[model samples]
Target: MLEIITSSALPVRHGFFTRKGGASSGVFAGLNCGTGSSDQTEIVAINRARVAEAMGVDAGALAAVHQVHSADVVTVVGPTADRPRADALVTAAPGVALSVLTADCQPVLLADPQARVIGAAHAGWRGALDGVLEATLDAMEAAGARRDRIRAVIGPSISQPAYEVGQEFFDAFLAEDRDNHRFFTHSPAGRYLFDLPSYGLHRLRSAGVGHAEWTGHCTYRDSERFFSYRRTTHAGEADYGRLISAIRL
Candidate 1:
C-alpha cells in the first residue's frame, strides 16, 4: 500500500517513498519516517519498518545517518549502534538498504548493480553545493561501484516554480560559482526561483556519473503525496513530516 516511485535506470531494488500509507496523524500525517521529528518514535519506527519490508530487507538492515547536511558519506559495512552523523550512505553488502530522510530536499538514489554497490543521499542546497552527490559517488566507488555504470535518480523535491528565494540565497549560489546563476530565474515577485532538481542533476552529471534523472514530482506542490518543509512553513504548521527513500544491493 506504500506509494513508492522508482526509475528504470536503476536495476537494483530501490524506491522513493511518498508520504502515504503511514501510521502518523495530525501535522506529521502519513508515513513520517523521521525519528528526529516530534512524531512518536514508535510510529516512526513502524513507518521505517514498512519501508524495510518494501525493500525486502530486515528493519535493522535499513541503514541511515543523522544527516548533518554536509558532504559526509558513510560506507555501510554492517549494522552499527550509532547512526553516523552524515547525510549519505553507500553499501556493497547485499540485504542492506541505504536510506535517506527528506522533506523537499532531494532524495538521491544511486546504483551500479554490476559492481553490487548502491548509495542513498539527503541533499539540500547547502549539501549539494558542498559536494554531497560527488562524495556519495566516491563512497560508492570505494565500495566497488563503477562510476560509468552507476545511475542516479533524484526523487521528489521542490521545483523552481514553488521555490521562491531572496536575493541573499541567489547571492550564496553565485558566490559558490558563477555558473550557479543558471540554476536561478527571476520570479514575478522580484525574487528568484531556484531549480533544485536541475542543480542536483548538474552536480551528478558534472561528477561524471553515467546517468542522472529526476522523478519530476514537486514535493511542495503535491501535498497529498509528499512532505514539504516549505509547504508546512507556508501554512504556519507546528512541524512537518519527513519522507523516506531507500536502495538495496
Candidate 2:
C-alpha cells in the first residue's frame, strides 16, 4: 500500500507520497518516481502512474517539469505538451495534477481552494533562497488565487541535524541576508547545520501567505520511508531516487 501524507490546510485531492509500494529494486527501491534518475525509465513511469492512480487522475494528467533548481514557475492549463524547465507549477484547471520531484529538497504543495488554484514546487536551498515559493504564489495569484487565501505545506526534506555545511555555504546565506544566521547553528564538528524547512516556512510567511508548515519529516534521517540525496552521496551510492508530491484542483 502507498503511504501518503495529507494536510488539513489543503482541502483538495493531494498527497505527499512516501517511498512505499513501487516497482524499482536495489537502492532505488520503493516508489522511485524520478525520470531523471539512472533507474530504468520504464520503472520510473510505472511508479509515476501509480501515483497518478492514487491521486484519482489519468497517468497523462499528472504534470511536472524539468526542475532546474531555479525560481521559475509555470502555469499549467492542461496536460503539458512538454515539461518546462522550471521549479514550480500552478494551475486553476481541475484534472491536471501538478507535481514536483525531490530527494532531499522540499516538495511544496500550495492551494487556494476558494479560487480553484493549486501549485507544486521543488524547493532546494538554491531555489528556495532564489524565491521559488514566493514565485509559486505569484503564479497562483495570476491564475486567480489570493495570497491570503492560499495554504502551503512543505513535504519531507533534509533536517538541520543531518545537513552539515561548510563555511562558504554559511557565508552565502549570510550574504543574502544577515538574519539568515538564525537558520544556522554550529555543530560539534565545527560546521553549520542549515534548517532548510524552517527557512522555507520563513520565506512563505514573509511573502504574506496565509498559512505554511513543514511536515517534520527528515528525508536524510528516515532512510526507509523517504529518499535523500545527501544520504545517497554519503553512502557513496551511485544514484538516488526522487520522491513525488502532487496537488490537483
Candidate 3:
C-alpha cells in the first residue's frame, strides 16, 4: 500500500506521497516519480499512474512541470504534451491534479476550497528564497482564489537538524534580508543548520495566506519512507528517488 500524508487544514483532496508501493528497485526505489531521473521510463510511468488513480484522475490528467528551482508558476487548465520549465502549478479546473516531485526539497500544496483552486510547488532553498511560494499564491489568486482563504501545507522535507550549510549559503540569505538570520543556527560542526520548513512557513504567512503549516516529517531522517537527495549524496549513491505530492480541485 502507498503511504500518503494528509492535512485536515486543506478541504480539497490531496496527499503527500511517501516512497512506498512502487515497482522500482535499487537507488531509485519506491515510487520514483521523477522523469528527470535515470530510473526506467516505464517504471516511472507506472508509479505516476498509481498516484493518479489514488487522486481519482486519469494518468494523463495528472499535470506536472519540468522543475528548475525557479519562482515560476504555471496556471494549468489541462494536461499538456510538453512540461513547462517551472517550479509551481495552480488550477481551478476540476479533475486536474497539480503535482510536484521532490527529494528533501519542500513539496508544498495549497488550496482555496471556497474558490475551488489548488496549487502545488517544489521549493528548495533557492526557489524559496526567490519567492516561489509567493508566486504560487499569486497564480492561485489569478485563478480566482483569495489569498486570505488559501491554506497551504508543506510536505516532508529536510529539517534543520539534517540541513547543514556553509557560510556562503548563510551569507546569501542575509543578503536578501538580515531578518533571515533567524532561520539559521550555528551547528556543532561550525556550519549553519538552516531551517527550511520554518522558512517556508514564514514565507507563506508573510505572503498573507490564511493558514500554513509543515507536516513535521523529516525526509533525511527517515530513509525508509522518504527519498533524500542530501542523504543520497552522503551515502555516495549514484542517484535517488523522488517523492510525489499532489492536490486536486
Candidate 4:
C-alpha cells in the first residue's frame, strides 16, 4: 500500500504520495514518476499509471506542466494535447488531477473545496522566492476560488535541519526581505539552515489563506522513503528520483 498523506480539510481527492508502492529499483527506487529523469521511460509511465489509478482517473487525465522553477501558473481544463511550460497548475475542472514533482523542494497543494478549485505547485528556493505560492493562489482565484476559503498543504521537503546554505545564498533571501532571517539559523559548519516548509506556510498565511500546514516529512533525512537532490549530490549519484503529489476534484 502506498503511504499517501491526505488533508482532512481538502474536500476533493488528493494525496501527497511518498516513495512507496512502485516498481523502480536502484537510485530511482520507489515511484519515481519524473519523465524528465534518466529513469527508464517505461518505468515512469507505469508509476504514473499507478498514481492515476489511485485517483480514479485515466492516465491521460493526470495533467502536469513542464516545470521551470518559475511563478507561472497555467490553468488547465484537461490533459492538454501539448504540455505547457510552467511551475504551477490550477483548474476548476473535475476528473483532471493536478500533479507536481519534487525532491527536497516543496510540493505545495492548494484547494478551495467550496469553489471546487485545485492547484499544484513545484516550488524550489528560486521559485518560492519568485512567488510561486502566491502565483498559485492568484491562479486559483482567477478560477473563481476565494483566498479565505482555500487551504494549503506543503508536502515532503528538505527541512532546515538537513538544508545547509552558503553565505551568498542566505544573502539573496536576506536581500529580498530582512525578515526572511527568521526562516534560517546558523549551522555548526558556519553555514545557514533554511526552513523551506515554514517559509511556504508563511507565504500561504500571508496571502490570507484559510488554512496552511506542512506534512513535516524531510526528503533528505529519509533515504528509503524519498529521493533528495542534495542527498544524491552528496553521494555523487548521477541522478535522483522525483516524488509526485496530486489532487483532483
Separately for all candidates shown, the number of backbone clashes (residues 3 or more apart, or on different chains) is: 0, 0, 0, 0
Error of 1 at 35 (Å): 0.3
For 152-196, candidate 3 gives per-residue lDDT tens digits of 999999999999999999999999999999999989988999999
Q: Please give the ranking of all candidate structures by lDDT, highest first, separated by commas.
A: 3, 2, 1, 4
- Judged by whole-model lDDT over C-alpha atoms, candidate 2 comes out at 0.94
Deviation in angstroms for 183 in model 3?
0.7
lDDT of 1 at 119: 92
**C-alpha RMSD by candidate, in order:** 0.9, 0.7, 0.6, 0.9
Q: How would you encode candidate 2's per-residue C-alpha lDDT over 128-223 as one tens digit per residue? A: 999999999999999999999999999999999999999999999999999999999989988999999999999999999999998999999999
Best by lDDT: 3
**Which residue pairs come into collision in candidate 3?**
none
Worst 10-residue lDDT window, candidate 1: 75-84
TM-score of each: 0.98, 0.99, 0.99, 0.98
Superposed model 3: Cα runs more than 4 Å off: none
Kindly indicate the candidate among 1 and 2 with the higher TM-score.
2
Question: Candidate 1, residues 1-249: lDDT per residue as tens digits?
Answer: 799999999998999999899999998889999999999999999999999999898898889899899999999888654698999999888878889999999999999988989999999999999999999999999888899888999999999999999998999999989999999988997889999999999999989999999999999999999999999999999899999999987
Residue-level lDDT tens digits of model 4 in 88-148: 9999999999999999999988999899999999999999999999999999999999999
On a 0 to 1 TM-score scale, where does candidate 3 land against the true structure?
Answer: 0.99
Candidate 2: residue 91 lDDT (0-100): 93
